[model samples]
Target: MTRSRATLALATTAASAAFLAPALPASAAVTKGLQDQEMTVNQPGLTPAFLTAAQEANVGLVRFNTRWDGQASAPDPAQVAAIKAFATKAAAAGIGSIEVSPNISGDASFNPRGKGRGPKATDKISQDAYRAYIRALATALKDVPVARFYSAINEPNWFRHIPQRGGAILYRRLHNIAYEEIKAVDPAAKVLFGELLPYARPTSKSYPHGQSADPGAFVREALGLTKSWKGRGRTASYAVKADGVSLHTYDFQADPSRKSSKRGRDAWVHANLDWAKADLRKAARTKRLPSAAAKRIYLTEFAYKTSGSDKLSTSKASSYLKKAWTVAKKQKVRSFLWYQLRDPTSTDELWQSGLQTRDGGVRSTWTTFKGLR
Candidate 1:
């Protein structure tokens, strides 16, 4: 369908109409589960072996980071080949859903183009490229059964990203394009919004003030959180555009010292997550839908890294995972997808959020997580 036609269909979902946001039955379908996929390395074309592992883990969703430039720039034969293979396996395993990001600034292609954050970017090419890229990618994956949900950006509100692009405009347009096209392809499918990074205000007195967690700030900005914050132009008007919302939690990032102690770590996880849950629900209520509509948050990307010189111990990792699951259940969250399936590369320590190590071997946390009901 043409872009204009697609938008016309979604635009029909006016604020006055009480539309039923249709979705697949959660009963026969899989319940909310962890995501185990990363960007650092390419797996062997989504092999049967990997499918077996994901199925064994009983995960309902296998999340993949769909980078717009990475795949579309060269359309890497191997990478495209892997995505097709992965989709097939996920369908067979009943673990379906692909969450994608358009503005992957850190990647070699976009990062060099410019620097700064939020929705209003100084780089014209980078910004325009990102929008066109997402539209193209969304069109490509529109037919994949396993590709159910689409998140416009990875984490735009995060300090590392936001300061470069600006926050409000980035998400508003991204979501506008994604929601319009995704629904056009399959109106029954669910499009999740705001995969916010979960972090709390730093407790350290050394760090300066005015910096809050990325997700919180994004919401505050997106919904016009404050009276003084001037909004970017309204390229796309906001409505209850998405079926669900998304958030990513990793408490370890909040601590300046990066301590692995039990008390310190647990506090970080709880406080940050609690803040996220409350903020998301509030945003959804005010900006998304009626106060009674079933607005939900999907913890799509979350994990504790323990592979550095002083990573969390295996026992500690397991404990953290358990506690996270507990909190997720308590929060009445829609679903929780862990950060990764396997650490596909060793190039960066941050890439080690997977349940398996660099070599594809399972971690104790993986074993513990696989047993979750």
Candidate 2:
């Protein structure tokens, strides 16, 4: 969870054989590709470079999560301007869409250990706040043709819960309310679900029985009849289903150090994706979930750290990133997104996943991915 430092450099999004690589035997399909980045509310200035890089990489989408604290009372005008600016820049760059969330885990105040606002309290207030946030966001982007989808929150499953309720319940509840509010204004906008944190650790304190709720487990719980997600039925409304599923993967955390032989990493990717797809398919089969108009997986975030205290060499990071693109093509994932367009805070540990270092320098992964398209 701690991000290390890295040298910053500008990256060019030039396509490579790697980006257009053929499918691997065990991987899914990839259609659209994206890169994730952190942008603060009211910082619309950063959108141009991000869209430019995304266009260079041939990726059409960018993912960013909104912090509830920043927009709880009324949506921050600066943040609103930033999103609109992103859309304008993306359209000029010919990038496809933007995904935004309200109930994301960025604000420390909302996080359990940070300010102790706790997930439950945050969830309760944020859920209501999200309706307004999404409404306003959608309204702002309404004229922006480049934008495709909007989300209410980032990863709700990681939020803490009260004694009786857990993160899954809170997540589902928020999604339900948010979806209703979103569609009430804009029915055409697509909503994305399932932005689960990639790795599931056995030591995590966020799940039932303390067994650790990985992405799969979170999905299982959401679809489980006994769970009563969102303090109501396990089923999500049709409006919620209108949005496609969203996901991010980073095997580095699961198997850092490139220590896991290639075979092992491939196996891990195969298993994780297979399990997720199977579960979604099962839900659809049981008629418990709506069928996706589009059925490919979207890897909203994926990267290997290349510098700082825990730096992987540039060569190794590039190799890892290439392998991920290869696997995505093989897996037939609808689209894959690299972690970031720009590195915001050098102090923001997670920002190390960026294609560029904090100072705006390129990592090897950045070059490799540029050629991927």
Candidate 3:
């Protein structure tokens, strides 16, 4: 998150991979992992370091995000090669699974931050080009047998990744295309979607134009579960389908077990997982869309900020993380990833949640992460 060292993650060729881990016991049903784009992806030389540290903390899985740029027919060959190499190295290190998401910075590929008349409206990558990019990357990985658990994209509900105006509709189209392309490359490939942003404003009106939609609204609209927000519906050429729904469940201001007292509100935070799970179940069974997707869930990214003003500077992350694991088990989460491993020196766009602190030492939360098992 410090923006200097974002690299790759581990991988599995298929379900039959010999490195696949045994299922955890009931008390440790959740697969605890880390999502440090920096330490895992950027610093290959540091692999042995983090691998040892992860083993110390009992982390078995890692999530890596690769930012793909330009309209090249595919992702960068060098990056893919590095990722494949990392996958091999990680598997050798006893890492059980990996999740990779190829993301595009800003709203489009025209420029890093398109903000002009020509760049703003027309900045989007065409459907054909995007399809080709996803297809090529997935194809390349699949050939190497590395296209294991692929996330369609980062948080589409957030304004930073996508323009909030018609954002869910746009993400739905992209996700469906990604699904088709990845599945076309490897029919058995596991594709996951919707690492939705967990934070929500207090009121519906709080999300004005250009601001992001809440996770609940984004899910209903993107999945075409509502009459008003029906996007390229069941009859459309592209339908929404995924093996599991992923969400970010950060509740930094309070304990993860803390619930909102607001009545009739659905924000989809950690405390509202029941609400989130119900929605997933409905989608899995709903006739409006394909019932191919299951009610499975993945908590792809979440952590409490230890130093940020947003966290009020006195929060106890280690304790909350312990409770978070309990909540995850109760909710039957398929995967649980802390947002990052090590913290930056200071002031890193508001995210300071790390099992290891900026001092390059483990936090009490590091033990908390291990105590999940």
lDDT of 1 by residue, 177-214 (tens): 66776576556556777766554345344323222344
Candidate number that wins on TM-score, 1 or 2: 2
Each candidate: RMSD to true structure?
9.7, 7.8, 5.3
Per TM-score, the best of the predicted structures is 3
Q: Best-fitting candidate, measured by lDDT?
A: 3
TM-score, model 1 to reference: 0.72
Per-residue accuracy of model 2 over 187-255 as CA lDDT, tens digit each = 656666766565444433433233224565566566553222222343433223535666666666333
**Collision pairs in model 3:** 5-38, 7-41, 7-42, 8-41
TM-score of 3: 0.81
Return the lDDT, model 3, position 263: 21
Q: Output candidate 2 Cα RMSD.
A: 7.8
For model 3 the local lDDT of residue 347 reads 50
Residue 200 lDDT (model 1): 36
Clashes of 3: 4
lDDT of 2: 0.52
lDDT of 3 by residue, 1-373 (tens): 1112222222211111123343222243687778765555555565566777777767666777766542446776655665666666565455666676766555333213333212331245456677888898787667443336777667666554555555667778878888889998788677887877775544233333423557877777776666333344453433577776778877666677878674223467888888777766665555433444445677888887766465623237777777788899898888788886777444543566667765568678777777776
Error of 2 at 36 (Å): 5.7
